[model samples]
Target: MDRVIYNFDSLSQRQSAATVPLRRSIYRARRVPEPRIGIIYNPRSHRNKGQDLACAGADNAMVAQPRTRDEIAHALAGFAREGIDFLIINGGDGTVRDVLTMGQAVFADRWPAIAVLPKGKTNALNVDLGAPADWSLEAALKAYASGRRILRRPLAVSRVDEDDPAMLGFIFGAGAFTLGIEAGQEAHSLGFFNSLAVGATGAWGVLQALFGTNGNKWRRGTQMDLRYLPGGAPLPRSKYGDPARRSVMLASTLERMPMGIQLFGAPRSGLKVAVLDRPRRRLLAALPAIFMGWRPRWLAEAGFHQLDADAVAIDVAEPVILDGEAFPAGRYRIEQGPELTFISV
Candidate 1:
């Protein structure tokens, strides 16, 4: 990877020039302190394209390493031991999830604040945090150096079993959709774009499972029990009164929904959870709901039952995908956890 070096003195002058207004805003909010950043970069991430780009932009300020989850957690634990104030993770979604999970395990107060540099195939979490979809490390650093106030939102954590540790990102279900992702891993050698092509192929597989000649498995349907722990009470099953009961695309989060889709309008406080369940009806009724540009009033009228508890559990007869990764089939649960902060531009 090509490397570029910006003299520290010049960089400092540039930052001072850019942050004048932002610094004033910070002072008004309250006394702001310099954040000690712990960076985790995946040397082998995204076919090494992201890594090469990041390496080229090293002068922008980064800590480069080929650390895994355990290594990163230990490093962060060391930083916490030394009193670091924040963390900046530069990798893909899996890297972000690992750091968040490790933070939960290490710091009682949730380690340091986090900022992500989108360097992965699917930076879903970063997108939710308002980071630019096409962001490069250099661009991210400029925004960081400008000392702007970072917009932060909470995150939802899920666990496959009681004994299993919680997951820090999204989760999904639906037959071939899950299987196709599993199959795509075999073609990782094709590189970063390959991963995306693999994902597109996976989606195609899902469509084929739903409509093509090879649709027997999906058509047969698998039975699974989905329970909502709304404010700790089992949501009463009403035909249309409770929205959470319906299952089209179930997502619970304190962050924005992906693909610019707002399952529910922006949530105000606590966790914002939305469940999209497909009713056993004609495809026409579902097609409109899926493709309609406007917010469906039915979603609002069909009030969602609040899962009062910090976490909600999901039981499945088959293996489910959490952020596109397949796990052993069985019961699973979802819940909220400590806030992992992020810097947004």
Candidate 2:
């Protein structure tokens, strides 16, 4: 029997080179060449209602105003048909969600580099991507032509059955969040929006939960179970609290949330989740600290749980919010979706 010996070092070097990510070279800083850009403008968006697009002179771009959801899907299909290399979303978070949802088929397998004009009532995605509130269509176009590209993977939530279209977004909330959003709407009607609205709504929610007693809907919360899905393990539960239900359940792929609030306390990308097993008086007092990302021993004692995972199964029977939109109550799987490149300002 003839024996052959292979050099382990050589084999390792070959394997490493084969796995060297193409992104190192493919994403090298360079001018985008005659990019075909598509702008999906929502005329009803708070800031975009009266403002004309600033990049009208850019012949390489095509603008579409889509009012209805079906119109949005049609507009995206048209843009895809034109072979757009870049897409600029001009609206708030909800509009962005609409684009991502409707255009999923058009951008299957690969998505064009995207840019966002912070023209919505709540531009949380813009905040995370460092696109300031003043990010304009012209600036977005300029960035698309020459600017740093940020690669982000938005969270995708789908029903457990996987029979329906999935929703792609940065933030998701349930339980108390659904109640809070109702209050936030009242705040919005009063001209409070963005971070201020969030603070107000959260404060109101805390008050309701604390003073409304156990039977109050906000305080009563809803029944939900979070289990680690494939590629993740069941997270550790605090010994002091029930392992099944949570009072506040929220998750996101964003590192920096809207209004500079650190909800995850040093979030580690992917899908980071925070589940509070109902709030006690002490937990209510510590919420400001929690919002500031300060995790204290007392908070953990009160059942504050945060973790980063690849996927989670949420068996929820209450309405859920995805990027500011309401979704019907049901069991769903939340996970990190495809990588999307953004043209940073």
Candidate 3:
């Protein structure tokens, strides 16, 4: 199935370091004393497979390579018990999502400051934090000791029917957005990543919808019952379009995305959303401006809806992608999650 989140074979796939052209210059810092930091390293991230993270030299640095949720929670619990001052996430979006999701149970309120070494296939969070592809633990430790940091809140998603606590992440999307990620995985296999992968996948998806026959998956859209949370009112249906069908629905907490894409209009905080009520013929030509964050005055009337959301209730029969992973179809509540401080230097 195209919508299936991941393939195990792909998880262990390896690519030569020279092939990825994002950034090769390593960010270094002068000698700085390390603080008590627990490092959750993902050996499976794109850049971290064969190379060991070089933080073992620091006296206060502790590293854990956890392969399961239980192990992640256990590691975080140990960190919390030891009262580490800084927590370093040494992977990309998926690893970061896993840490935040499991760490919530271990650090409920008094969360430790985090520093991410963006080594994932898609490092959107790192892009927002201005962390380059070569950002290192040494640089992060220097920034931390210098007291430089920024705050960001993750998106908390919970099924309305389940008793489980909300899953925390930075990006969330369903419908066509899910398709885009599926294409992105293929792009990654071809040795393209970050902005190039994002652009290629997006172009492929758009071209398919534009040239494909009627009733295609992209054109048909997904059946979703979306309404604002705590209010229970539906978003107004577009002119002559089905109220429950949307071609694209994406939400994010980041100010800047890969390839400089921002469907939510401008760079602002909180949950910014973009939902399109199915694709139309007129939309084909406007793709360039739309991807560039341009919003025409008549766009809202044509079914392109941008929302600054507090919370939303979603009921759909298709899988939704959070970060780079997928969740099954069901009724879900999406809201702002806990605020966390991160070192930005």
The C-alpha lDDT values of all candidates are 0.49, 0.75, 0.78
Measured over all alpha carbons after superposition, the RMSD of each candidate to the real structure, in angstroms, is 11.0, 12.2, 8.7
Model 2 global lDDT (CA atoms, 0 to 1): 0.75
For model 3, how does the per-residue alpha-carbon lDDT over 1-345 read when each residue is reduced to its tens digit? 134553212111211111123333432222235457799999888889899769744566778999866677778878877878789999889899878887766766567789899888879898888877788878777778774577788998888966666778988898988888888989998998877888888888888788877677877889898888789988655873566688878878888888788667788899887888867768756967986877788787888888877898889889888888988888888989888887877
Query: What is the per-residue lDDT of model 1 for residues 1-345, given as tens digits with 9 covering 90 to 100?
Result: 101211112322222221211111221121124545556777655634543444454442336364655566556666666555546677776676666655555554434556677766666666566777666655654555554444443344444434444556543443444544555554443543323644455445445445644234433334445555654454333354123323332444534544544444543344444433333333324333443244444543343222333555556555555555555555566656554445567
lDDT for 302 (candidate 1): 47
Candidate 3 weakest lDDT stretch, 10 residues: 10-19
Q: How many clashes does each candidate structure show, in the order listed?
A: 16, 0, 0
lDDT: the better of candidates 1 and 2: 2
Misplaced by over 4 Å in model 2 are 1-31, 231-235, 239-244
Model 2 Cα lDDT, one tens digit per residue, 1-345: 001211112322222222212232233223458888888988898887777767655776888998866677778777877878888898989889878866666666457888888887768888888887788777777787667788788888888864665678888888888778778788888998777888888889888877887777876657887889885466555664445666888989998887677787785677899887777767787788778878786666667777788789888887788877777777888898777888887
Best by TM-score: 3
Find the candidate with the highest lDDT and give its number. Answer: 3
lDDT of 1 at 70: 51
Lowest-sum lDDT 10-residue window in model 1:
1-10
The alpha-carbon deviation from the true structure for residue 329 of candidate 1, after best TM-score superposition, in angstroms, is 2.1
Q: What does the lDDT read for residue 263 in candidate 1?
A: 40
